[model samples]
Target: MGVIIVLIGMLLSVNLSIALDELPCHFLDSINITDGNRLANDDSIEFNGLVYSRKQYAEINYVLLRDGTDQITVDPYIRGCICNIKPCVRLCCPLGTLNTDDTDITVCQDHDKGNKFEAEVIHKNNETKVIPLERFFAYIEGIPCNFVYFDDDYQITHKGEISRGNLSTKLTHQNSCLHAGLNAETNEVDLRLLTCIELEGDDYDLNQYHVIRHQIINFCMLISVVFIVATLLAYIFIPKLRNLQTNCLICYLICLAISYSLVIFVTSFGYPSFACIPFGYFLAFSFFSAFFWLNVFNFDFWVDFQSKHRFKQMSERKKFYLYLVYGFGGPCLLILFIYILDNTVQLPPNMRPGIRDGACFISNILWYFYTPIGITLTINYVFFLLITLKIRKIQQDIAAERSQEDGSLMQKALNEKKETCILYLRLILVMGLIWIMEIVSYLMDNFSPLFLITDILNSLSGLFIFILFIVNRRVLRLIKERWQNLRGKATTNDNDTSNLISRSAAFMQMNPILTIK
Candidate 1:
């Protein structure tokens, strides 16, 4: 693993608008002073007791210089903060205490009476030790480091994080990382992190960061569910908006809501009971249906624009009914097929949903869930490309037709419908991008809040849909008209009752002598 020295806050400002070829930041590997390959921007590194990737340090100044002294490089696929300095890492850990309550640092010295800092060490033989930092590095100088710290350190009680620069680190100030190649056996990157050894720290304290991350995610999920429900209610109450275009959206949102609600349930309460099995399958079915329905929406758009089609003979209502069968039914069929394979065949642990093994969330989410969604997304991408190219031809044809009739009423209506289709297309694109982030993060092994923004976006997708579909001028105007009509009906009923009472009284007066019980 190559270690790049990080300079915290010393960078000169340079215009970022320069051509990619001309821009000379630690971008050129040929000019890199470091004698080995550099770490990718996605690799995690720790500094000042906090763990994060170079990509996450957006505030840190990292002006790359032309000289070959900098170890950091701007990867074509990912970028990192660069510094022009010799690559070195501060090697230190919390000093040992007499006991859990001891307030004084119990200095453990070496042969020459030089100070020795306690560093956790785990060897290939599964033995763990709490020895001096210098000795520990000597032990791991030629091996892959994967130390899982336990509280059983014979002579050390790990307390605080590997921070406190004011504390003594003079012994490790000159320590530099050894260069190494990637280890393919364990699918592990040769990442030489300057972070502290993985120690048994306070679980709550260590977990608070992740807890807040999940809270943000849940908050957005609930917000989306609320808006999705609200959008459905609007359509349910206003019959005018329940046509083919909106129905497609409704089916997609319903599936999404089901999937989101199920996920929230699993995350919040967890599945410790027998109900887990059913919940897991239902969750998969709902999620797959959502993607299927989304694809159906995209397909409908593409098919409608096409001139020669079997569905062209049928009404919009008929086409939508057929779509419903495929959207919801197709996922149902997939779930059944999976259930059969799971029971009959001896599938690998990763291939089978862990629901059969009593796990709450579907175990091995990628193979079972993402594979199908990936296929759906691929199809959507192809359809989207075709749809975009097809729309231009549609606009031109419409323009010619309008000119022939000087913008007839039918042409005007077609234009308005075309505008709505464009809006829905934008909605599809937004959903696609947000979902793509989830897939990317999974592949990248998201361990930190570096990709928290993507989760936030995904969770709040319902709000985005609500804003796009329900909170628009067209839907709002329909709601206003519906309210006004209801009010007018009430007023008219009251007036009719009053007229009836007046007419009855006049009839009685005009025929007072002739009146009888």
Candidate 2:
């Protein structure tokens, strides 16, 4: 009898262990949705919870299971069984097909048709002494089967639409999923999931395009730095290049170089949050300074073409000092005004100057940056047109006087007008094209192509100016002449050293007898 009792106790122990193992054990809170989406697609998760169905969708019987930490929708394949007494009346049926009018109590089944199930609960009870369903068997912690038939309000979450166990919507400035898989060894998707659903196809292509765009911009900036520095040095050292027009060009190059340098610096080494305001300030100032100097040069060109004697009366230094106020001081005043407005006025969040979309750029273009730039560009364009007509009229006058004057004099006159026209064309190509592309890019809804064009043109402006104005035949000639002069001076110094050495040898020879004595 003792042996039989021990055998019965062991049997009961084994049965209890099996029952405990089959009980709902996994907590919904511990599982990450992104990880669960990848690894637990076919895996069954069991949790203890109450099924809360939407009141309007009573026929479909789709329900949400809320664990203490998180919530997930259960599959519609779940079946309901009623248990009232020792022997429960088990009616196994699909979610929509369940006729619960005759039965008030039901235990959630693990499978649709099989008898393997757990978690007994009361369903649709209105009595005061009713017991709520405490245990729930969630087949999957994600969207229910046939989710497309559900209404829009059903899947909305704080982050975005909860679709197929993934947050398919995007938040403001969100880039990638926080819970995306990092380990390759795990059974998970390796690609970084986007924060938003890809409504338009070719998301990978778009990402690649942005990467290429930045690469091109960096390359152009590097080229601009090298050429602009060379141009500035040439203007400073070479006397022939130091006219009023070239001085203005020097200022423009300086501003362009600073702007490009700041862009590269911010891109390579990201600034802190506090640096955004200063960064925006300097960046806008430099850009505006560049445009202002370009306008100054345009006006100077028009002045030279329209009234040569009057332009010559204004000394290069005087012109530079006068234009400096407009070129540099104008941006300073604008920056000061913006700072005051930012401090005194309460602007919208979008209008404030701070880091947005991962870069320190002016967020409000219409008021702060673009408007001024647009006005300056319009003025420059008007000057450009007037200068073109002036050049044409000069050419016509020179042609008429060609029969009266010497051939050489007429040739020289024609050459001067030609040079003026070339200069104006170069200026337009460098400044006008870039700003036009910028304006078009700003106006367009889809700016992929326009942004590419704008970046390329704007970044290469310094290069264009250097090539057209600074690296020309005249500048090259000056550099060559200076190099030749330096070489001649070095040869003369070598000859002088040789003569001094011979003189010392002769003196030693004369004093040889005296030294011997």
Top candidate, metric lDDT: 1
Candidate 2 Cα RMSD (Å): 20.4
For each candidate, what is the lDDT?
A: 0.57, 0.54
Using TM-score as the measure, the top candidate is: 2
**Candidate 1 structure lDDT:** 0.57
Report the lDDT tens digits of candidate 1 across residue range 389-433. Answer: 776654555556565543454344445546767787888789888
